[model samples]
Target: MNHINEALKHAEEEKKTRSMMSSGKLRSTLEEIKTEGNKAFSSQKLDEAIESFTKGIEVYKDNQEVVKLEKCTDLTKIAISLFTNRALCYSKQRRDANVIADTTYVIENLSRKNVKAYYR
Candidate 1:
């Protein structure tokens, strides 16, 4: 009984530490990447905007790997937004297939409340 209790206590402490570290650093980094993508889009720099969004997507994938290893749920709003923004850029560039692929990924894997994906 004592051994079981000790193991459970250690697991709880590890879970707390993982949650803290993941939320703080990962959220800020993702936010910065998303901001950069939005800024490029607003400036009418389509290529740069796409590049920024792509970087955000890459970071999002890395985040997912970490979340999986840590056995936690990742809040994926920003990641979905990154895909949506990339789709918008593709639409502007007349890349219909790419736009479709991105929007489909968001709609299928993320939230139904992402109305932007529907319109895209």
Candidate 2:
């Protein structure tokens, strides 16, 4: 019984340790990606910006820390920025399909305030 209990505790501790490590790594990568995306956007590299933002989003998509309701606000902001950049790029290239798709995604995911502010 003692050995069994010890084994269980060790297993649980290992599980928690792994979870914590992954959480921290996910957060760090997300921040890095966001910063890179912003830099790319400022440099007029729209496609690269989109790639960075999308990769960051994918990393956080299933994280419990990222899934919290409070984090949605920031997530929405990222989504809006990415989609807006993509839309603008499409507009410049005269790609109506991409522009509509990106615009629709931003409107659906972002807050009404953001939608109104961006459109205006």
Q: Write the per-residue lDDT of candidate 1 for residues 7-115, one digit (tens) a residue.
A: 9999997785565436557777878888898999999999999999999888777567555556534448788889999999999999999999999999887777789
Residue 116 local lDDT, model 2? 32
For residue 104, model 1's alpha carbon misses the true position, in angstroms, by 0.5
Window of ten residues with lowest summed lDDT in model 1: 66-75
**lDDT, each prediction:** 0.82, 0.63
Best by TM-score: 1
Candidate 2 lDDT tens digits, 15-89: 755564254455566667778887987888877876786776566554544435345455556555655655665
Best by lDDT: 1
Candidate 1 stretches greater than 4 Å from native: 1-21, 65-74
Off by over 4 Å in 2: 1-28, 60-65, 69-72, 116-120
TM-score of 2: 0.54
